[model samples]
Target chain A: MVRVHNLFLSSDGYGAGEGQSLERPFGHANPVELGAWAFGAASWPNRTDGAGTRGLEDYLVRDFHRNVGAEIMGRNKFSPCRGPWEDHPEWEGWWGEDTPFHTPVFVMTHYERPALTLTDTTFHFVSGTPEQVLERALEAADGKDVRLGGGPETIRQFLDAGLVDTLHAAVSPIELGGGSRLWTSPEELDDRYHHDVVPRPDGVVHHLFWRR
Target chain B: MVRVHNLFLSSDGYGAGEGQSLERPFGHANPVELGAWAFGAASWPNRTDGAGTRGLEDYLVRDFHRNVGAEIMGRNKFSPCRGPWEDHPEWEGWWGEDTPFHTPVFVMTHYERPALTLTDTTFHFVSGTPEQVLERALEAADGKDVRLGGGPETIRQFLDAGLVDTLHAAVSPIELGGGSRLWTSPEELDDRYHHDVVPRPDGVVHHLFWRR
Candidate 1:
């Protein structure tokens, strides 16, 4: 299945905030507030305390990389660099040498670049429509599901093309006045998916959708 | 306390749909879809079945008319008629002869009209600002809490003035592409109010806000 997991959104439908920079990938959005749920999960990969909350959030946190073999993301999500790859030869993405993904990562960009490997995760900068990108991602994913990572517009394209099979969007209570909006309202995907709106005790509403 | 109860909204933050008219008070919004939670609740006054779901939603349904002694609504909510009183001379509003509201109802209008009565509910047409209207509503309430009946813009006025002490906004899963928006995000009120985004099993996310 082509899936999107743990995509956080604001009540007003903004996925990320405005004024994104290399220093702040999510722009003006307070990463602490946005990632609190994931950070507190017992299964959180980056948890330094050794113990965290074991709630439904923990289950999701554990499921983040369960069977995902490959990841696909928008170009902007890959790096803050907006121009040609030549402009920033030193930029190896926000993730350092040892990246998160254990599988191949496809970065959808208009300006294609040769495959670059940061330890285990190899990034292939490919340019194509949603279908073409998914084909490459699916092939790279092997038998497992391909996780579609987003910066909002990327996921929107996949959703619009009906290429997405399952989507798990967590809406945080905070609202960014302006930003890259994921959907005017999530119901826009109702025609193609069966939706389950589940809310956690911590004021976060999770929208889980599966293709019908 | 000045309260807003069961104020339904789309996921996009729209409280009511666009092009509201005499026939459709909520414009393009489906009343059945919007009120499903309340309609299914055992405490819903209008429920003919007598037996409905006994959940948090039901509790809210029962709480609807609790201590609310008076109601303050925008003129547009009172009547869709944009012109003068003469145009809607015989229009007794969308509510029938026996209006649901048993207490005094205050309708804010630029062009005032004499008070009218329909069974137990007395409709009082008054002109004033948010504070002014709230004061009148509070006075008419006679020590009881006042209900702020809205069409979105009316509630926005009260919110802007910080006149609303409590607000209960139920966000339905549906998305109205465009309409009268309640807030860019529920977080916009976070500065002055403590917000709780609680979601029921039926997919309705209730945003409860109380003045801090």
Candidate 2:
């Protein structure tokens, strides 16, 4: 089964910033504190003797990383490039050489661009409906789990299609008064997502949900 | 200066997770990986020259620890305590004897609890409006910058009040499908935040945003 996982940051009640530039996206207060708490798990090398992190939070990060074979993200995540792809030719994979995603990354964009093959990962731009991208992702993932790495519209499309099976949501303690909304209402989800909370050493919370 | 900062993970759409419990709160994809990262960073004694950390991520961590005189968070952040004060009593800080917020932490809660004096830090619960909390935070912070520790609601209050002057939001590559929305559409602000993007060797984007 393809396990579609969506990740995001929480603003007070608004969608993310209008221009999701690399510089400022709702201005996170403490990136280090948040990062240490959120990603300070197994994926990165542990400076400590594997102490301090909550067991549950560590489990979720590992589960997502280990299970994910392929990822599909909207063009917004791939780059700040918008409008026709021809306008911005300098844009490439956000991660210069060593991207976190070692597997294949499918970018959902309207513009046509050549596939980018990096040292460990490749970026393939997919046009058309999100379903098309998911199809490509499934093919790329083979039997492994496919993650619907998103930018809101992309994940909503997947969720609307009833594609995601499991989701792990991290609720950071900060809110952007107004920018973006994760889910307008729970009804958007066809069925209830099993919910659980995983605490982190940095005082953040991770909410996990999976379809029954 | 009192520096209010917000830290949280993004759910593919800038929203935080919900029903944060012991099971899933912080975005830990893998348990083992999460453990290793936490342990490594927590093993502060072992971090020699911080050379082991990958690139900008290392700098971001170092910067977080280096800066900030004191830390402040909400009641939810201090402990998993719920309901009125009587419901949950005698709750010590989360880190036991050696809490990470070695600096002073001013927790905002309705119930009044005795101050917790730990080995390296002290926990004081302040019950009042956001302004009152800010005053106490400023006093506690003294000349040093005050870290606005989280639990979304609290951070939102501070941000809405325009208490945060500088924010360093590290946009991790992962996405959470659904949870708590950090920013919503209704809330609006006119302040301009400046940012500088620092790419970590690990592909994490460290965005440092400051208000001019």
Candidate 3:
């Protein structure tokens, strides 16, 4: 199954901003507010130190990587570089040598780059249709589920192609004013999915959608 | 205090549709789905037959009229005739003589029309800014709260003006592909209000906002 887990969105449905740069990945949006829930969750892998919240937030953060074997992301999610990749050969990525995805990670971009291996993670830059890239990731995932780690545009591509089975979105109680919108209305996917909303006291609502 | 109650929106934040007409109050969108929660609530005064759901939906529906003594709406919401009032003399409104709003209803418009009284409900066609109309409505409301009955644009006008004290929106699971958007994100109101999300088993999430 292709599942989108722990994707944070502003109340306006924006997953990221328009001018995502190396300096401002979310473009004027405070990155801290966007993913504040996950950051405050004790189970976030990046939180090796004493940081994050407990309970549902922590459980959800911890559940993000469970039973996942591989990941597919947009090149933008991998790095802020756009158009061609030759301009920034020195840019390894936002993540250091020890990347989060321990499994094979395929990055979709028009510009092709050679595969780079870091620890258990192997970053493979590929240019193809969502289906073509999914095929490779599914193979790498073996029988396990594949995770769609995104910058919204990548996840939207998979969603538009009807390649997603499950999606979990954490909607923060803030507006970004302007950014890259995910779904204009989740009802656009109603033909293929059943939606459930889970509300929490922290002012965030968990919108879950699964294939009907 | 001005309160907006029982306003329902799609997950995308559309409260009504564009090109609203008398035949289609919510434009191309299904009016039933947009306000389905209110229809199924036992508290809905319009529900003559054994319709509406029990519990929270009913409670919220019943709460719509609790302290409301008057209503403020845009001209389009009162009647389908756009541009001028003289264009449609025969046109009363989408609601018949016995309109749902039993109190003095102030209709904001550019063209002025004499006040039309029907039963306990009186429709006053007045032209003024949000603040000006609000002044009249507040006076007519006496000591009770004034209700901001909307068509999205009207509610947004009040929201933008920072006049609404309490806002309750029921987000239906269904989506209207195209319509008038309510908030780019509820977070736009975060500067002045606190937001709360309450999920109901009916596949609708109740979004409550109040001035901080």
The TM-score values for the models, in the order shown, are: 0.51, 0.45, 0.51
Query: What lDDT tens digits, residue by residue, belong to model 1 across residues A1-212?
Result: 78788888888888888888888888888767877778877567676786665334654666668679899999888887887877677788887887878899999998988899989999999998989998998898889989998978999998888888778888889989887789988898888777767767778888877766
Docking class of 2: incorrect
Query: Which structure is stronger by lDDT: 2 or 3?
Result: 3
Q: Model 3 compared with the native: what TM-score? A: 0.51
Q: What DockQ number belongs to candidate 2?
A: 0.02
Q: Provide the clash count, candidate 2.
A: 83
For each candidate, what is chain B's TM-score? 0.95, 0.76, 0.94
Q: What TM-score applies to chain A of candidate 2? A: 0.80
lDDT of 2 by residue, A39-141 (tens): 6443342334553332233334544455567998878768766777665687775567777788899988788778998887889987988677788888898
- Cα error, candidate 1, residue A101 (Å): 60
- Name the lDDT of candidate 3: 0.80
Candidates, ranked, lDDT:
1, 3, 2
- The DockQ values of the predictions, listed in order, are 0.03, 0.02, 0.02
Show pairs that collide, candidate 1. Answer: none
Q: What interface root-mean-square deviation (Å) does model 2 yield?
A: 14.5
RMSD of each: 18.7, 19.0, 19.1
Candidate 1 at residue A157, lDDT? 90
